[model samples]
Target: MTSAILVSILMTLVAASTPILLAALGELVVEKSGVLNLGVEGMMLCGAVAGFAVAFSTGSTGLGLVAAAIAGIATAMVFAVLTLSLTANQVATGLALTIFGVGASSLIGAGFVGKTITRLGPVFPESLSGHPWLRAVFGHDIVVYLSLALVFGVGFFLRRTRAGLILRAVGENDASAHAIGYPVIAIRYGAIAFGGALAGLGGAYFSLALTPMWADRLTAGRGWIALALVVFAAWKPGRLLLGAYLFGAVMTLELQAKAAGVTWLAPELLATAPYLATIAVLTMMSLGRKTGRLDAPACLGKPFSAS
Candidate 1:
């Protein structure tokens, strides 16, 4: 491929990866706090539709993003209340949340179907953003850069900070953490809220940046991929970043194939590649887990009561 073509592909990969990376990072924190939320897909949908609605209605992508975050938080709180407060089954609750999200988004977004808006713009001025070679470094929008910054930020927060240590302690042994004066339940609530907010932003990236339009299930199943990415990265932020891009490359194969005018493979088959890759990657992770040190937080998905 020509250098220009390569640059274009690279840019596309970054944009494709940003939403998954954003959602995975939020989930990493949520899992680290001993909660396994499977409703990430639901949260993303809520964010996507809300973000699109606000942006289309107000003519402000920024406001749309804010709305998306709020929607995500609201949806996540439902899961939180069930799993954390009522001490409901985490797995079932998560599944229910996803169902609720689909219905809620469909109902709330019914009026927004088929609408379009201006796509999010690059943060840097055109001079830098449009530079032939420098575009690789400067061409992305604010959310793209924010996702990169969050990768390091999450890694730092999990590994280097006192609060991180405490969160880890909670994940490792919530009863102990609670006995030691840390508020296990409260910390978890904060973690869940944070994850929901990021998941919302990730969903917003789809409506406001990637497609710049409203569609039912606009996020598709990227949320599930984000969930797998957490395990694929062994819950490490750095690995999650790399994994997101790898999956992003897989996801963009359809576009690349069409661009190359390869007629042998059907576009439908190419479209399935990313989901197939997700299944394959997850299978490998499961098999590898049999031999490796268990990397999962011990208390993940377990309920805690102050009894």
Candidate 2:
């Protein structure tokens, strides 16, 4: 019984962490290419609604994921055009994107309210996923495994590949990357799109895997947590995983407390726990800046143009 309880908690931690890790990995790539997209929250919302809508209508999780990715990409393009092509402020545009996403997703998800669908389940057979001891490893949906794979894949892509070199160079100094004959704007565009798709997938994870239903602001500011996670990870994929799970555990505490009917802790304080963790991370980043431990992309949050 004790082991079973432990496994259940582990599963909850993995589920909560997966979305944040996925979103942060994409943002890591985007920041690596010198773009700071604050629109992760908005893009995620757009993806959540889009994924839920498509999946609900078609009853295919795969198609719903595709639609979510497409929605993320489309929404990301708006930021790309404004910041990359027209040279708008990346920060302001990102905030606008989040606001737009919140409003748009609320509008779009209105019909989906109170709707529930079959949660995305593990790909493997019940023999594994339902096993008493193996469930922790095999019980989760595919998104959980994919998110883990992405951690290594992203770390490798950024650290080992020549293309990764160029992307980093673009982030470090786009003017130099451009002078060396790299397409700065194009690389950033691709990075932004990739970020969007992942953010969308993460968003869908909430609807399809986590809660399996729709509600207004279903994501509940996880996108912002994802944004801080990139910084907490110090732009490294491994650290991002740790940060994500840490935050996830913080979030899980609230659920667990409520489930156990713990009366000592206020629900409001529990709700604030995750956000407080976010603030602590952001504060760490700020403090690290003083100690010179902060090493973000030099050109991050800066607008880039070929001209």
Candidate 3:
């Protein structure tokens, strides 16, 4: 019984972390290219509302996912124009974009509050599902699998690809890369859009698959956690997966404790465990900077002027 319970807890952790992992993966790539996008929260919210609205209207989860990605990309384009083209301050523009997204999503999703949809379940083969251990480990909705694949894909791309090398070079020293003929602004724009799309997909997953319902602020700061995860992982994709699952497990455990009537912990504290843990991790990382160098792109969050 204890083993079964533990397995269930682990399963819940993976399920809860999928969305964060997806958003973080995209942000990792964008940051790798020296672009700082703080609008992930807004993008995710937009995705959630757009996805819910579309799924409810068309009665197709697939279309809803597509719509969410498109919305995210559109929102990101606004940021791209501001920061990349107009050379606006990246941090300020990103925060403004989030503000816009939050307001826009709230207004757009006003009618969708409290509405629910029939969610599409996991799509693993029956053979995989039949195995108890494999089912616990591998059986999940399509988005979960995609998130895992993206971790590996991003890791490989950053480590092995020439294009990725160029991206890194641009991030590390934009002026040097520009002198050598790399299109820094163009690359950053594309990476920002990609990040937005991924954030949107994560939001869509929350609405169309995870909760299958509409709620204002449904993402609920998951975007901020994802941003922290990127920093915690030191911009490494492999470590991002570990950090995401750890946070996810903490969140699931809090809910389980509440469900199991654990009398030792206050309900509010349990509910706040995830955020508290995030704060603790960030504090530790900040204090431990001397032990290892945290490698951020040299040009990250800086405006570049093309001569």
Give all candidates' CA lDDT scores: 0.92, 0.91, 0.87
**TM-scores of all predicted structures:** 0.97, 0.97, 0.95
Residue 147 lDDT, candidate 3, scale 0-100: 86
Q: After superposition, how far is residue 292 of candidate 3 from its true place, in Å?
A: 8.4
Query: Which lDDT tens digits does candidate 1 get at residues 30-118?
Result: 99999999999999999999999999999999999999999999999999999888999999999998898888889988998887899
Measured on C-alpha atoms, candidate 2 has an lDDT of 0.91
Encode model 3's per-residue lDDT on 196-303: one tens digit a residue.
Answer: 989999888889887889887888899989999999999999999999999898889887889899998899878888888999999988887875447788888988
Ranking of all predicted structures according to lDDT, beginning with the best and ending with the worst = 1, 2, 3
Candidate 2 deviates by what RMSD? 1.2
Candidate 3 stretches greater than 4 Å from native: 125-133, 291-293
Clashing residue pairs in candidate 1 are none
Angstrom error at residue 111, model 3: 1.3
Q: Which portions of model 1 miss their true places by more than 4 Å?
A: 289-293
> Which candidate has the highest lDDT of all?
1
Cα deviation of 214 in candidate 1 (Å)?
0.8
The order by descending TM-score is 2, 1, 3
TM-score of 1: 0.97
**True lDDT of residue 232, candidate 1:** 97
